[model samples]
Target: MPPAHPFDFGAIDDDEGDTLHEECGVFGVIGVTDAANFVALGLHALQHRGQEAGGIVTHAPDVGFQSVRRFGYVRDNFTDPETMAMLPGQLGIGHVRYSTAGSKGQTAIRDVQPFFGEFAMGGAAIAHNGNITNANALRRELIERGSIFQSSSDSECIIHLMARSLQKTIPDRMEDALRRVEGAFSIVAMTRTKLIGVRDPLGVRPLVLGRIGDGWALSSETCALDIIGAEFIREIEPGEMIVITDKGIESTYPFRPKRPRFCIFEHVYFSRPDSILGGRSVYETREAIGRELAKEAPVEADLVCPVPDSGTPAAIGFSLESGIPYAMGIIRNQYMGRTFIEPTEQIRNMGVRLKLNVNRALIRGKRVILVDDSVVRGTTSRKIKEMILDAGAREVHFRIASPPTAWPCFYGVDTPQREKLLAATMSEEEMRDHLQVDSLRFISLDGLYRAVGESRGRDASAPQYCDACFSGEYPVEPADMVEQGFRPKTAAE
Candidate 1:
C-alpha cells in the first residue's frame, strides 16, 4: 500500500489530543542588524515550545519599549508587513506561552508574556519558561511586603523581587531575586539597555547562548539559533546568569553551584531532532536510545518502524542495531489546529484519529517493530497499535525510546498522575497484554543517560534532569498531593 497522505482533514481541531506540557519558549536578541526579524525567526523555531499566544518587546530610541502581543500562534499573530512595520527595535525579546499557571482563567492577552513592567529604577519585561513550585508562598511573602502583582503567574514574583532589590545592576537584582525562588525556570528579561537571561540553579529547563557577528541571541533551544542564523556557542551553565548589552555578553553566577539537571525529556521528547542541548545532539541521542534498546531488548520482527516524527530517529537506531529495514508505517495529519475543534470528549477522540493513520501498504501481513519516544497514558500508543493491526500487521512489537514513566513531573512537562501511567501500575508483561502487542521493551534508565554520550555517575551531562516521571525520584516533593488537587481516587473510599 502507498503511504497515507499527511494533510489534516480539518475533521478535528489541529490542537486536539495529548500535548507536551511546555510552560513556554523565550527568545532575545541584542546588537542584531534586524533584531525584530531575528526575534520573529527565533520565535518561529521555538513555536513548538508553546502555542497559546506569542509576543515581542522591542526597544525604540524615542518611545522606550513597545510591544505587540496577541493570543495565537506565532505565525498567526506576528510578522506580517503591517505588524512588522510596527515592531521596531535593535534589541528585542519574544515569548510563546502555554498555560501552566494561567490556563484555568481566560487566555487573556495580558497573561501572555514578555510581561512588560514599569519600575522606579527602569521598566522591564520578562518572558519565562518553567513553573515556580513555591509561587503561592512567594506571592504571599511579596504581598506582606506591600508589593502589588499584575499577573497571577509566579513569573510576576521575580519582578516584584527585582523592584525590591537595592542592587545597582539588573543582573545583580535578578541574581538577588533568583536566590529566593525555587523549582524549574529559564527567564529572559529585557531592560531599557540590557537583555538579562537566568536559569535555575538545578537547570531543570534549557537555555543557550548563540552568536552571529556582533549580535548575541539567547533561546531555549539550539534549533532557534539555526533558524536565526546564529552560531551555537554553548549552553548557559546550569546555574548561570548572562547579561547581554552593547558592552557584550557578560556572565555571572549568584546562586550556589548545584549539579546540572537539564531535563532529559528534552532529548527524549521535547527538543527538535536537529537541536543540540547541553552539548549533545538531540538526533544522535535519540538514535543511541534505539541502539541501546535493541541491545537491551532484542525482538524478532520483519521490519522496524517509528510512530512518526519523534519516533523516527530512534526507530532508525533500532533498525541499525537489530538489522531490520526501517519503514514509515504511520502517517500524521498535518492540518490539525488547537482551536480547530470544540472541547468535547468525543470530539477529542475523533481528533486523535484524524491526526494519525496507518499506511496499509506498508504493514499488511508483516511482523513490525513499533517505536515511540515515550508512552504517557498509553492511550495514544494503544490507538496507534490498533490502527497498525487494522492495516493487517501480523504482529506489533512495541519499543520505547526512554524508560517507562512511573512518576509525575513538577518542573514543566504535564505528565499525568502516577496511576495514569501504564508502567507504574503494571509490569512490562502486563502492559504487553493490555496493549495486545506481540512484545514490549523500553530503554533502561542507565542506558538512556549513556546514549547522550554521558553516564549516570559523576561527570554526567544534565546531572539534574528531573527523572521523577520515569524513576519516581522527584527533585522536590509537593507539600501534599491533595493540597495540589492531585490526590488519587481510592478504589473504595
Candidate 2:
C-alpha cells in the first residue's frame, strides 16, 4: 500500500466538508507508568470524533512537563515509539480536535491541544471537548485585562481565566474559571500528579471514567477505554468534576444542577456505534431511529440501503421494519479518510465519488431507499442521487434517521451558516424537489426522542435532550455570534 497522503486542507472550498463536523474528544490517565501511551490509544479510538490534529501533555515531577502536539491522525503521529518515549509520565491528558470555534482547515499547531498554562501554584494542561459560546466576549475582556492569547481557539480562554484565578489549588482555580464560562464542555486536564475530568452543566458533550488496573482513566467515550483494556467505570455527572491521583479519585460539583441536555446528534451520527451513551448503545439507538423512520414514512422500495458506515445500522432497522431487503447499494473507500489530498480540480470535482461509489450491480433497476443520517447543504445528497441515477436505479428515496437540521449548533459541532443550511432555507418538500428524488422524509423530533429511549417523546416546554439544531431550542445562548448580528430563532421565522 502507498504511504498515506498528507491532508491538503486548503485546496477545496465551498461546502466541500458539507457534513456536520464533530467538536473534539478528550482523554486522560493517572497512576499508570507512561500514562501518555494509554492516552494515545484512547485518543486513537476516539479519533472519529476529531481527526484534524491531536496533542498529548504529560507530567513527571522530575522531567517537569512533556508535550507533543501534531497535525493529522493519532496512529500516524502518537503511535510511534520515539514520540511516545518523549511523553513519559504517570499523569497525562490528550485532545483530538476538529476546527470549530477556531481556525478552520489547515489547523495551526498552536490551535492543537491539550493547552498548557503556568499558574502560580504549578502548570496545568486542559483538553476540552466542546465549544465555548461566549468566547469572543471573554477574549475581549481578558485581552483588555492584560491576558495575552497564543491561539485563536475559544478553549484557550479557559486557560487565561485559570491564570487569573486567586484559588490556591489548580482544580479550585479551574472551578473559578469554569464558573464564569458558558456553553457545552467535557474536559480532561492534568497537573503534576493529578488527572482531572469535568462536564459542563448541561452535559452537552460526553466524558466517561474507567479503571486502568492500578490506574484510573477518563475518555470522551467508553469505546476508547476498551481499546486500552480498561474496565468501564461510570459517566462523570453533568456539572461534576473528578480529580484523580495515585491514591484515589475525588469528585466535585462546580456548576449548579439543571436538566441534562446532552447533544442528541451523538446518537444520530457523531458517536461510534460500539460506544454506549446515556445508558444506551449508540448502535441500538440508531437502529431504533431507522425503525421509527420506517414506521412514520413507509415507502415502497425494492431495496433499503445505507449511505455506508454511519447510515448502515439505520438501513438495517429500516429493512427489518419495512420488510425490504437491505443491500450495500453504496460502497465507501475505507482508506479514503475525511481529510484527503484533492490535488487537482478534476479530482476535486469527483467530490463524493472519491469517498463513495454506487454498488452498480446491486442498485441498478431497483427502487432504492437511501437511509442517511441527515442532509446538511444537500451537496452530497445531490451527488449521491446523480450517482444512483447514473447506476440505473429506477427511483431514489431519502429517509433521514434524524429530524431536519434547521438550526446551527452553538454547543460544539461545526455547522454551516444558517442561510447555507439546506434545511434552514428549504422545507422538506422543497428539499425533495431540489434533490430530484422520488421522496425525502426525515424522522420527526418526537420519533427521534423515542428512538433514543425517550418514551414520552419531546416535551415542547422542556426537551430531554439538546435538539438545538432540529428545534432551534438552544440550551445556552450563543453570545458572541449574537453580538455580531447572528440572530436566534424567532417564532415568526
Candidate 3:
C-alpha cells in the first residue's frame, strides 16, 4: 500500500479569544425502533449546548450503518424527511458541536462529529463532549508512527488510539485508549449491536442514562430525556462505563475513582433551566444564586429586570427576595442565537442590537436593576447599561449571578485568555465604573456554593465543584497549554 496522507491540524484556528464556549453534547439510544428519530429529538433538545453543526450515526440489519452530518441546527437538517429517510436503524448515536478543538470556517464541517472508524473487529462510532489537553502531543506521536488521520477534531485521537490497541474486544480497546488520554471527557459510543457511555474520572462534564420503554438512552442532560418521553434512571458516574446490549446494560469501572468536579458554570449558564443537574433542578439552582446575590448585595431599586432568557429565572428570584417588582424591561429577539459565539468583536457589537431591545416606556424615570448571568469582556453589559440610561432610567444597577471570572478555563470551556478577561485586570470598583452603572455587584464565591446546596460554603482546600473561572484553582493542570507558555492568573493576582 502507498503511504497514508497525514491530517492537517494547522488548518484549524485555535485562537478563539473572545468568549466562553461549551464544548459539545452527545446522545445515544439502543433497543428502540426508529432510533435515529429519537436521537434527533435528543440532539434537538441539546442544541443549546452546541449549535454550529450536528450528525447522527445509526446501525441496522441488511442496510448496515449510515450517517447524516450537517452544518446547521438539528431542526434544519435532521428533521427533514429526506434526511431522516436516509438514516434507519434500531441503534443510533448523535452529536451537536460548537468546535472547541477544531477549525471555525467551512472546513469545520469535517469536524462535525459522531466520528466513525472501521477497525478489524467491527465499526465503532463515537461522539465526545469535552477536551483532551494532550491531543496535540498525542497527534504528533501518532503521525511520526505513520498513522494518518481524517478530521482536525481532538476527538479523532480516540480512534487513532483504539486502532493501535492490541486488545481483542472493542470495549477493552476503548478503555485502553482512554487510559492514555488526559483532561475532561464524556463520551457516547456505539458498536454494531451495543451502545456505550463513559465519563472521565474527574467527571468534569456530564452524561446521564435514561430508559425509553424497552430501550436505553444516554444523554448529556435530563432535559433530553424529557424531550423524548424517557424516564430518568441515573447519571453515569465518573470513571464508569456502561455497555447496552441485547442482554441488558453491563456496568464497569474503567479508571481509578477520584473526587467529582462537575462544572459549576453549568448551573450559571450552560444548562437549560428545565434540566436537572447534580440531583438539583438547574432552574432552582440559578434562582437560588439570585436570592443569594440579593442577600450579599442588596440594591434599593424600583424595578428588577433580566437580560432575558438566561437571566429571567435569576431575576425572578432576585425580585422575590428583594420585594421589587419584576418587569420585562429588555426584550430579546427570539430569532437571535447567543452573541458571544460570534467570531469577531464587530459582529458581537452588532449582535447586541439585533438580539435585544430596550422597553423605553417601562424604563423611563424608574430605578432599574439589571440581572445577568456573568460579564466577560464588559462589552455587552456596558452597551446594555448605556441603552438603559438612554431610555430615561433614573438609575441603573447591575447584579450578576456568579462571581467575577478572572481566570481562563482550560478543561473544555472556551474562555478567553486571562489578560483579555475584564475582571482579570480591573478591581470591583473599577469594573463598576467601567460598565458605567450606578452600582455593580457580583455574587461572592462562597455565596455561589451556598446557593448550590453547599451549606458550609466552598472549602478552600477541597472545592465541591469546578469554579476555576472564579477561584483560579484548577482540579486538572492544563499540561499542554502550560508547555505552550500559557500561565493561568493566580488567585492572589
- Ranked by TM-score from best down, the candidates are 2, 3, 1
In order, candidate lDDTs are 0.78, 0.87, 0.85
Least lDDT summed over 10 consecutive residues: which range in candidate 2?
A: 1-10
Best by lDDT, which number?
Answer: 2
Instruction: Give the candidate number with the greatest TM-score.
Output: 2
Estimate the lDDT of model 2: 0.87
Give per-residue CA lDDT, model 1, range 52-120, as digits (tens).
788899897877888988887888878688987777778899998766422433455766788877776
Task: Estimate, for each residue in 265-365, the C-alpha lDDT of model 2 and write its tens digit.
Answer: 99999999999998899999999999999999999999999998899999999999999999999999999875545347777778888889899999999
Q: Which ten residues in a row have the lowest lDDT in candidate 3?
A: 1-10
Model 3 regions lying over 4 Å from their true place: 1-19, 337-349, 455-463, 489-493
My TM-score estimates for the predictions, one after another, are: 0.90, 0.95, 0.93
What tens digits encode model 3's per-residue C-alpha lDDT throughout 247-342? 999999989888788889999999889999989999999999999999999989999999988888899999999999999999988976543554
lDDT of 1 at 115: 83
Superposition error at 144 for model 3 (Å) = 1.4
Clashes of each: 10, 0, 0
